[model samples]
Target: MGLLVVKNIGLLLTMSNRLAIADAVVVIKDGVIEWVGPSAEFDLDLYQDCTVIDADGGLVTPGLVECHTHLIFAGGRSDEFEARATGVPYAEIARRGGGIAKTVKATREASEDQLFELAVPRVYSFLAQGVTTVEAKSGYGLDFDSEMRLLNVAARLDKATPVDIVSTFLGAHSIPAEAKENRAAFVDDICDRWIPEVAQRQLAVFCDVFCESIAFSVDESRRILKAGLLAGLKPKIHAEQLARTGGALLAAELGAVSADHLDFASKQDAKALAEAGTVGVLLPGCAVSMCKPDFPDPKLLQAAGVKIALSTDYNPGSSVTLNLPLMGSFAMAFMGMSAMEVWEAITINAAAALDLQDFVGMVKPGYKGDLVIFRGADPVGPFYEYGGSKVAKVIKEGSVVVRRDPCGGVTI
Candidate 1:
């Protein structure tokens, strides 16, 4: 946490209005960026003993932020994945006890220690891809006890790893099979028992509900989100992924932080989100893996002045990959986002989606010293590459956390 300086950055994409800069110098002190600008403008004699890192004329940018992920589950959903590939509907699969329900059973059957062990590598995988911060959700465990265990595992992972984990209580990810018949009572339990408990224990910073036709309805999502807001926890929603169901409008009305997976959101919804100052987070990984590429109209959202963010939605069944670069590729190819727009989606806009815009996301002074160096041609070179983003080194809190060999293997 001492003084550290990075000099000779060839292409520094700050994710700011000023955009990329050439030959930049970034001075970090105590794991926080103290100064960043042209290399010529940096004063060398102020702290002669500072550790210096030469960028080797490489492209440097803010470390990626994965704002949406369900990476704290104990089991894989390969069966459900294959079933969906064969044209089985998610609702039908869930009805037959094969979707999230299956994962819930596996998660509940596993011990807290087992869940902790399982989540460690998942966090590492994101870090290996230059993701320094992550929003990991606990949704596979639908019951209160199991949900608490999952969240505790997430918190423990945050302590064990260098990557910052933002834990979310997604107790309304789906109604458990046991509570399917009595939906109202189960919802009441979530509003009364789960929200208060999660808030009191400081178990999660955000509370999320899957608002869709196959999951909680718009009304149910509203009830749960309102309860969380009242309990002093921030609100987020899995909105309009399966169907519109008014989730977008509800999120805007409730003043939620973000509305995600908006494959079916309308232009009106985009306007409402922009008016309400809510971020629109997309999951192109899920679209590419499961559904057709009928994504939320990026042009409508952009024209409406809605801020956009992207995530892997890294889950067992829908989006199995933890590759943020791949999601960027998909965003450009499938979601009609440009290279620069996609970069902001994963970095600055992602931090905004998590309500952490002031801290992480940008390579600016007063922000955390989380940075990524890429072996690429220019600022947008890695993102535009075909196979994968050529990540060279990942620095978090002024420490080199992950490094990639010349042969393309990542080590942390």
Candidate 2:
């Protein structure tokens, strides 16, 4: 809330072409970055009334940003998790009344307080791992009333925490069983009724559709996305996760913000995405959990000049993780990416996925003062040591929001 200065940083990963800086000084005033450069040039007279934080020769970086997650639901899907791991077809599981449907039933029965309580702990988990901003989707509530309630719960969670929440409307995640008799009617309901209501209320910043074989068809997905666009929300898609249903090509055609989970996306699709300047988001965490063979080709995507991002996909059914560091490790070992690439995937490129790169992804003058200070000597320590954190402090909006305990726990 006041002037703050961070000095004596051993290493700073700026997510810029130059990447790393040494002996850096960062100056913040009124929650925005005022200056960043070598510590030798820091003007002492400029910060006479500022709070100074010595970084103790440690690693500093822009706070992590999570691009995709499904943390707003009632119950866990451990049973479906096991079924998928054992090679059961997801469609069959859904038909047997066991997948997202099961969770939707539970979410509909849960009250707003219950939903908010369930979501708060998850936010803490993300913050402990150094994620300062995250995108949360409302897919479990496919109907109007529950869907609205889910977004409202997300709003409440945002108000209750320092971590910024970006709510996404995913009403086309699946077709309700009751609507199976006339899927057309259900699609119409989403385009004609749901999009307008969510948009008018300003409950969500973006609208996403599950454009897969198990969910909406290409035509259906396009219609839903178009309706959301008309209603003034950005468009994104859960494209090519299981099978290529023409989602990626469609995303590029319309210049959507991102096409996520492109496990089965072709090189042609990657090229299209690159040309359109759409982000190609990979979800290696979900691939590892689901044992998916066709993990996205990061090298190909990179060669095509596409900006790549990684995510936890922190849903109960597929990727049951908020540990993005682990996801980074998985991206390197399994998705054929370098440590620098993985780091960029979660920072600069990930910010682009949310259309917030200009504001939050860099430690530059005029950017938001969101940063992570690690106790280690190098910025890569947090990604190198998966399932662990070397974070000494987490700053959001120029204020210290989280500090590490001596016992390796987080405190606020």
Candidate 3:
């Protein structure tokens, strides 16, 4: 194998605190980082045919990872957006035939091919912002065939795009209107019919339930998640979003990999998450869009020794934005996280939520060479820039998949 050298790095934000910044050159070979040391120590003659990428004193960091997203769905919620802007309450709209149900209707009506074609541009939107990996969930389809259609489309979209997409089966996101009176039956369908088929086909990697007041109760959520585990899918849950129903506690009890949307989580929930080793995935975008008074207190969670991760929670109804840099900035400004802390949350911690931390989160020897270069010296500026800066370049598996600004822009 040959080496590819990235030299003249302005600053390297390695995940290690001691080795956080290095005025060094990184040597990559066959899609893995081979060596990282001061530029002067480089033996340029060792690899004659290796590709050379000059960093030009720019920031080099591991590619951004969107730990949670709803990037696989059809139809837009622009009507809901307009309604919300007019000072209409979100609950009011939901009561009047809107919200996730509207999306469910739209999604169920769309064909699998239609869903995949619609999702391609959105996936690129994430990649354009330097996000190389995203964990997407299929929750809009609350029924058997529609849910399977959503997941299959998501799988196909993953193959079509450059981004690594990990799908989560969220059959319990909500009970469709048809199942509104038969909630228990809907849960049964999710556990018996949906989980078995999806798990048997390996259509998704994780199983998620929206454990909310209007969705599944704590007991129902536990039952569905347990079934998913039996079917060989890892557990994740939407907990404490609108209100504190002990959903976080349930997630901790079940040893879920991650518990998301802790808008109303308490100090006790934080402690349980810490003890259970469940990562907390916070979505400020949803909070911002819904104008919900509750937002997760990251400081309390960190104090409890719980790991934190940030995500877009990108969806048509609640949050329509795919700009993770903006989410990072919002994570800091609104969620009360530091710039460095938010960066770590979005990269390493986010990767951990998807169980990909070891391979793709940080830059190190033997780690996958998934890299992103930013024009500014700091990753924080992308958030602070309010989406002004472009991703200079992106590399996946040691291949330059995206590079532009031949001088400083991203090209793919």
Q: Using lDDT as the measure, what is the rank order of every candidate, best first?
A: 2, 1, 3
TM-score, one value per model: 0.97, 0.97, 0.95
Q: Tell me the TM-score of model 1.
A: 0.97
The predicted structure with the larger TM-score, 2 or 3, is 2
Off by over 4 Å in 1: none
* Superposition-based RMSD of candidate 2 using all C-alpha atoms, in angstroms: 1.4
Instruction: Give the Å error, residue 259, model 1.
Output: 0.2
Cα-based lDDT for every prediction: 0.88, 0.88, 0.84
> How well does model 2 score by local distance difference test?
0.88
Model 2, stretches more than 4 Å misplaced?
A: 86-92
In candidate 3, what are the lDDT values of residues 75-168, reduced to their tens digit? 7778777777788987889888888888888888898988888898888878877888988898888888888888998789788887888999
lDDT of 3 at 283: 88
Evaluated with lDDT, which candidate comes out highest?
2
lDDT of 2 by residue, 60-134 (tens): 888899999998988777877778879898878878878778898999999989999999999988998888999
Cα deviation of 372 in candidate 3 (Å)?
0.6
- lDDT tens digits by residue: candidate 1, 56-137: 8888999999999998888787877777778988778878877777888999999999999988989998998899999989
**How many clashes in each candidate?**
0, 0, 8
